[model samples]
Target: DLTPRQVTLRDRTTIATIVPFSSRYGVPPTLLQYLSDTMNKEIEGGDTYPMMDTMTTDAFATYWFQNFGAIMLLGTYASASAVTEGNDWATQCLGSFYIKPNYTGRSSHISNAGFLVTDSARNRGVGRLMGEAYLAWAPLLGYTYSVFNLVYETNVASCRIWDALGFKKIGRVPGCGNLKSYPDRLVDAIIYGRELGGPLDEQAGEERFDKIRFYLKYGTYPHGADRAEKSRLRSAATHYRLREDDVLMLKGREVVAEVERQWGIAREVHERGHGGINRTTTTIAEKFHWVRIKETVSDVIRNCKECKDKEAAKTAVVVPAKRKLDGAAEEYLAGSEAAPSPALRGEQEQMVGAEQNDEQFHVPASPPQADKTLTPHQMDGEPYYTSLEYSGQTPNAFQTEPHGDLAPVHLHADAALSLDPQIMGPMRDDFTLGYPQLHDSTGQPQFAEEAFHIGGHEVGRGRKWEG
Candidate 1:
């Protein structure tokens, strides 16, 4: 049996008194020969440990002890009689493996390792002991996570050990394993993984923002003595030096986007109104700092269906355009046809009532006409237009036969027909009069002799206008 009578590190310091168990050099030659021979015998026909199919014992030992970043094992005490017979062995060996993250640049992580147990150590908890040790040491060795790539489906013992130790079965590969007992038959390979420190929360375990945070706190670069990186870090630190939480702040792209998406949704739905991009951006900036927050908010609002629907409803409310006349009768008649009809008065009333104020008009008794000139009178403290006196019969003197395509008759200013003051009541007082130089289908100045009120009142008709 093999036992540690004295333990010493490379420095010759006696660690046996401090360490609970004995530590030794890497897998010895005899142990490697034993493990290699056993793997070849037990795993050659089966699909387990396929990498060892042609590897020599020396090559196997070199690979594990030299190539691997770290090595661990399960040591069992043997009787003195067994050592005297020149026969002692390590129950199992577990080695740590690492690969470049994404097969690219450097990373502070590694993968779960595999182990080999001697036939005599089967069901003796030797595999479990090595696995537990691996879990404990992986984090200390700077591996935050570990993934078991191939656990044969038939290897129920190893699977159970992993599961009981908080490892989760994440996925499986079908027809990838060959059972030792059924070497001709293929089986599925299961993948298992677990975070040594438990699953990370949102933005947890992400170091993308760490550099910025460090610069914010120290007002200097964290690492990378390179001139370019140092310059960049210095620039970034200056930009954020005035910030209150610059040192502890997180400014990653995905991180900010996630926050904006959440807060934007809440503001849009919970706030007093449909607070759009402007409001959302402002609200988020008050709590968190990020550049281009407006752009992020705009993107969120663009995809929001409810806001789009509300905007569409607002755009659908339409007002009819005022009609204009021409010197030619046919052209004037055509335009008049497009004007809102008296037949639709009921529908117009219903719509106008819903949209306009109840105090729109305050029409009093109509006054008798006394003269041709217009006089303004105040109603509801606003000026209004009243009727003009007419002593003669309604004259048709201004009416002329339709002259085909005659040049538009531009009336002189003296012939201006004053519009009813009531027509201006609903509109703002500052509104510009659009009557001058009114064009017809011929695109020439138009002349008219009639005046109508918006309330269907014909205030002046058959009056001559020169302008």
Candidate 2:
């Protein structure tokens, strides 16, 4: 009777094992040598000849020397408890998959692993156990994730095993593996990704908006200032003013300083002018007077009267003069006498009444005929005085002066001028009774004397003036 020996596998942390490949399976030296030769011939005849040649013992030793300070070879064994079978035993060689720290980024989320099983160990779950042990030990060795860069899609068993062990396909490359013997018939290399509890969650929209707001407020993106600085300033004007002192603390301090400089310029403009800069009634200085800064240094350009007049002329409207009292009605009232007369006592009464009426109800006399009908000279080209009247101790004493070329004069005296009824009754009266005449009907004035020239010679005067 024979008892089967239990098989156990464990990790070896150092390169102490030098187990020969043939000795592990209990084969004789000659048979093992023959097996090695046959395996070499098979490999040389296969498409993996270049790979097999490259993966020699010397190459493995060089790889270990270059990569790790030490290498560990693990094993699995099975034995039968019987001397009749001449200590019949089975052994499998195992190689470790080492991941050194700091090979990638400072983050320990990435790791590398490799696994190989001997032909005698096929279908015995050795490879699967090795892979599972690697996955389980990687986290304790400070790896956040394990990435498998190349896994052939045609290798369905391995793909299923890795997929079952919480790894997902992340990327792929085409024509990567030998696919002729596989059912998929295509070489689709896959990248398996396993997340080992790092930051991996979808960012909220509110968080994104907050980031945008921060950039807008500070005039900077995540890295540095951007063109949105001005827009941010315009949007948060109040906030900018409130944080004016903190402007230097902002990320885009230069942009804020530029805006502040422009603001100072605007303030200076307002300080120098009656109306503020911004062309607005309000100003930054006036609005934010609590700030301790003095007025800004700048000059305001003034608008002259001419400019004002030109601007006013654009929309000015001409208005007609309004009539006050009618001139024709006033004239009729001046000429009409209110009362009348009779015989002796009645005559006296009438005389007294007339005097009383003359004193109390006196009216303006009709304007002088000379003034009313006097023709103006077209040659003199002088403006005409409208009407002439006199008030004085003597009749028409105030009418002494002729009308001036530029303006009409009104004279004052103690006595009033009385118009003769006979002369006033006529429409064509020569009312220049006591006044000296200055001009004739032909529009030639007596004062039309010659103008003196140099050397006492008068060249053009005394000649008829041309219009």
| Best candidate, lDDT | 1
lDDT of 2 by residue, 55-146 (tens): 44433433322332111123222221111132212332332233444346665458765444444444433444455555555565567778
Please provide, for model 1 over 380-465, each residue's C-alpha lDDT reduced to its tens digit, 9 standing for 90 to 100.
65544333444331222112223321112223243345554545565334222132322334433333445544566654543322
Q: How do all models score by TM-score?
A: 0.32, 0.28
Worst 10-residue lDDT window, candidate 2: 10-19
Q: Listing every candidate in turn, what is its Cα RMSD in Å to the true structure after a full C-alpha superposition?
A: 20.8, 36.4
Residue 9 deviation, candidate 2, in Å?
Answer: 8.2
Query: What is the Å distance of residue 78 in model 2 from its true position?
Result: 17
Worst 10 residues of 1 by lDDT: 14-23
* Colliding residue pairs in candidate 1: 1-78, 1-83, 369-389, 411-466, 411-467, 412-466, 412-467, 415-465, 415-466
